[model samples]
Target: MAFTFQINNELQFNHDEELLKKAEECCPEIKKETKKALHLVKLIQDQTQLDGIGTSILEKDIDQLSDYHLKRDDSLILDFGNHYVGSFSVDLDQVGSPMDAPLYIRLKFAEMPCELNAESQDYDGWLSRSWIQEEFIHIDELPYTLKLPRRYSFRYVEIKVIDTSPKWQVVIKNPTLITETSADYSRLEPLSLEDKTLQKIYDVGLKTLADCMQDVFEDGPKRDRRLWLGDLRLQALANYSTFDQCELVKRCLYLFAGMTAENNKISANVFVKPKPLPDDTFLYEYSLFFISTLYDYNKAHPDLAFVKELYPIAKKQMDVTLKMFTEEGKFIPDEDYPVFVDWSNAFNKDTAGHAETIYVLKQFISLSHLVEDEDEHIYTKALNQLSNYAKEHLFNKEKHLFVTGENEYNIASQVWMVLAHVMDDETNKKIMNNTIEQLFPIKNIATPYMYHHIVEALFEAHLDKEAIALMKKYWGKMIELGADTFWEAFDPDRVSYSPYGSPIVNSYCHAWSCTPVYLIKKYILNSK
Candidate 1:
């Protein structure tokens, strides 16, 4: 329940059977499709492609995949044409002389070609090497099906022979990925748009969301398959606008509510496999976002019964987070429970965190009214205090921007404050204009999640052209760099930046980056 759970296993959660049962009942049946390898390709250095790695489609036909024979040290790469979350398998047979030695091979699954450039053994990042999506196997017999049990999120699978024997070679054929997803692409209603770029951005964004959808709305199927609260908030918004899969959103909400700590503090994320369990990770804004997620869900697909069912758990998040703020309405960043404004801690987050609190408190108060919580005034007062503090203390009138630690004015501070609507309409526009003039050509900050906030803030300030331009610049650049789907982090200035010290660990199709669909639907399509 507290930070003590880090060292001691004193953490215990209340598993409401009814809520957990509803979560189980709402688990969407995972749909699967058998996809054959589309083309054979070789990875080569190309400056134009992502991470300076591009694929040259081999002349060989995928229909005759077995025709190619590989000797020891030979490797083959199969391009599946599109991104998918699934398990991979291929028929492996021996060629020439009798099977002498065991067939030792390494299979590396990559979401991007650049990831193939990163050697798993060379990956020295802080993230677990287990998440590299590489597997080493030894086959004692010939004519092996070689069906890997582990599911992988990838479009390229590289098979490298370590040693098959000097006498014989290996024949690879029938490479197939049993794709998994709970999202129904057929359910997407077709729409007409004039701007091709925005249309493409929305399409790619939808694909990104679909790829990440599973038993739960996973942040990244390739990596942290856990259901993160922060990702859930954004994914729910996008889902409402796109697939409209309310059951999945409700399942996710109930899961978070069902697995809360004894103190009713929701875990930042939850592990869904081997039975559902919550992780010890807790973020300040993430926990508070539970209320926001529920509020958005209700607005998109209203169900008072559902709102009432989860109201107490949602209310607890606001109640718990309000304690993090001081009597003076200043948010104190706790080392044990830090605010995750972005993955990068490169900037001061107190003001952004304070603004974020105002953002969630407003949502909490709205939900409080829906369920008729009599103590709604408590949340309203807290929201007023947080907003008043930001307007009075955090703003820099001279710069027309919000300042954080050491008098630093960052993009996040302004974006979240605008999203919170802490300032009036005219002031919000000035803040965004100043943010664009002073903070143009954004650098160091990477994460489509933050980019989504900035773009939405721009749109909210009635800067549609600026919003569209920024979206095209940031998200469109990912498309130019050969993103079949949007990436988790991309600072255009440093195209090769990775939080995990290697591009191999970066999520190319993350859920947080899928908000362009929501943004487009809300701002552009629904524009006056």
Candidate 2:
């Protein structure tokens, strides 16, 4: 009764043996995996130490402290190695439950493989290397023995452990400053439940992404057109706050290539002809962005050998895009096979080709950065061409905002102009700000691609605070309205659409929207 046919669309669980038997005929592996996951979930629940601690700290305990803006909690403790991190509350007026008393806390490790490696895709990989919280809590019953160093200030309590891990970037923000000296505790704070809960959700998202990509690889690219999916997977990973999580994305790409010529476009083993060489400009553009993100990972963590392995693939893809530049001096969007041609569709622009051209060229610029051996003059020329075109056609000196292409300008076109400036500073920075100002006043509007351009532009301009505020205000609203995941647009009314049905735009758990959730979670929350 808990799960009927309609309710369980995925058929994730079905106790009916007869139905299970019939379903097993079609996807035995799926049924088996589902059952295994269910079993694992149950087992993990029983084993997690945090589960016990969480039970003790009822929803009531949290509610009582809600008014205090309790940022750091020092009473609770988690022993990782020779250090401990936990949450505690503040009694500013010295009037609250457990007031003026030092609370002792300790937690045992609930899961094995306490450390994560970039290449490993196991469950533990999602655990935060520095400050990870688990579903289990096992609070100790020891009485507080330490005396208060300063009365009416803070009664410091220390939780000690012996960490066997090689590195400790994890930190406790508060009480540890008074009690411990081994690990850093500068950025620690008592995380809100919403934040804690959301972090877990993102970890699941990370795990889901990893599993999906592995399946795409296992199924082979020929059947799934995995290049697009791979690009999406890595993009999602790139949005993660932790450096280690980002490395996982690069490692997966490397694993998929398996020492094959990193440059050649690959299809899953299931494909008939290996994706037919990506004979279109879109393929080059899309692949280039992915390559650039990987390059960034390599630049930051040079020890990641997989990034080096991907260099050839990156160089080859760049060459394909660069070759598309015409002998007559224009980069044409046209391609022979045209596997992934996209025209700006979300918002009105002046002209399709005009606006689309700027978008493509900017992506190419990002691609240029990923390929180290490439000449600066090559991309410099492309940047100049795009900037000149924008200045001539899109710049509106009077309004200070860039005008849309041949058609009326809308959110989508502004996004393109903003991104172009961010990528190639050849364009006027004033125009980028102008576009952002016009777009900001428009309420309840969000396009996944447009948001990306805005964030990228703001970050480039060092407007981190404004960017965070914008994402939280507009995009954050979208998240509140049942965004189980991010959506393509702001769907306050929950409108649905179909791209093929004469521009019927609606929602059904789109991919672009999901990107926003990844971004906000990574940047604002900075969750591990």
Candidate 3:
């Protein structure tokens, strides 16, 4: 369509979408000197020459502003040495998100070639979607310097910018305050006070739950966004007695089914982004391998066709995982030596050495038999070897706990000990009871993440009532705090705490914590 539109609703101008689009594409390309710079794909043009605003002469220099002191309402009238650079205002309030406050800049470009580089001392806001610099940028044509001075919403939005290109045009967007008048979760179906209490318990338990599996879900690759496959299974497990429990399980089974292989090899990590460090662990490989077994149990009994469809991927990852272990009966951490396992790679042959490796090996061994349709020799042999290794190196028989040699021995190793005994009822019981006794005396037994492990051990032992009580107690606290999703740690006080100080990074809307819901539903109430 030939361009015909009113500028500012009064100044008439011909509008051609086709010409503008073509020009927009071409302008940014000319300015981009390298492939990386082309990421922004900016275009520039000298529209003043074409528009004939040759007489709009208006330049107002107040010289009252100091560096980094641009006011939110401030406007710089640029005289095109002709007609005034179309009057542009600071619209800092345009971005939406609670975290973005204090200051931001939005510009209305006057169809001209323009480049802006702020001074080094200019304070840059944190760039996540939640809290800080959340402004949206738009430019229409080439040589389009913004139409107004970079007026920021902040009282001191330090822009130590050194760029002086004969001062083009830019307009800073104003800050808009947003008031959330409605209560949280107001749109959802109203639950009775009792159901509301149950929801609170679920929320609280889930936050702690997320903290428990923090290492597994957040430590993987960009492509592995679905690490919550296990958590989904956990959610199904947690809601067993509720009316929605079955549906939850069905959805979980479908998601887990998607995660599995036809041959039954589960990918250990749903998300496994790699990094350079002392350790090179393939943590996801076996974690998913273990999770697949639980998923298989859900898949087999329900006969959910979606779950049946997921079995192959589980089989494939399983096969690939087992193959990683050597014929000499060693689970080589990876191709690399001196390997250390982090959250995703739970086993490392070098740093964790035999003890840690054996812990993960047992999970794989037990899962092997539980999931296998035929002979269990492969797993049995692996278990026997790991048992022998643990007896020889890892066990501190006197303390009745597995020690990390000398590395600040803690409860983590103890939890893994009980987990190792998953295949042996006697061994599991011993570790479970002893660990509980040890952890009982600690202050705040309600700490969600640690409590999750305790609940997991008890669940494994069929101590449903006890686990449910603890879940209820902990969840009650989380509900009072108004958590829409979950946290990286279980805040019994429901306090607003940051997980960034610790090892955890991703905070809101996690995947691993979803397991508590699964645990409560499946094992406690036996919903399936």
* Clashes (N, CA, C under 3 Å) per candidate: 0, 41, 85
Report the lDDT tens digits of candidate 2 across residue range 1-528: 110111212222112233223322322121111000000011112222211111122233322332322212322222222111122322222223333332222322221111111112222422233222211222222222222332110111222222212221112222221221111112223234365444544433332232222222211111122334334543434334322343334433443233222335332111213321221122333444555455455554554455545555555555565565554334454432132222223443332233444454454455455444356466668656655655655556576555653445555455555554533453435545665676655433434444555665665455557665665654455434323333334432323222222111122123333343345454556533
Query: How many clashes in candidate 2?
Result: 41
Instruction: Report lDDT (Cα) of residue 325, candidate 3.
Output: 53
Please rank every candidate by lDDT, starting with the best: 1, 3, 2
lDDT of 3 at 335: 41
Q: Stretches of candidate 1 above 4 Å error?
A: 1-8
Better of 1 and 3 by TM-score: 1
TM-score of 3: 0.46
| TM-score (C-alpha, index-matched) for candidate 1 | 0.97
Per-residue lDDT of 246 in model 2: 39
Q: What's the true lDDT of residue 251 in model 3?
A: 33
Tell me the TM-score of model 2. Answer: 0.45
Please give, for residues 24-141, the per-residue lDDT of candidate 3 as tens digits. Answer: 2322101111110001112223233211111121232322121123334343322111101112332322222232222323432221111122211232423232222113344333
* C-alpha root-mean-square deviation, candidate 2: 19.0
lDDT of 1 at 125: 81
What TM-score goes with each of the models?
0.97, 0.45, 0.46
Weakest lDDT window of 10 consecutive positions for candidate 2: 31-40
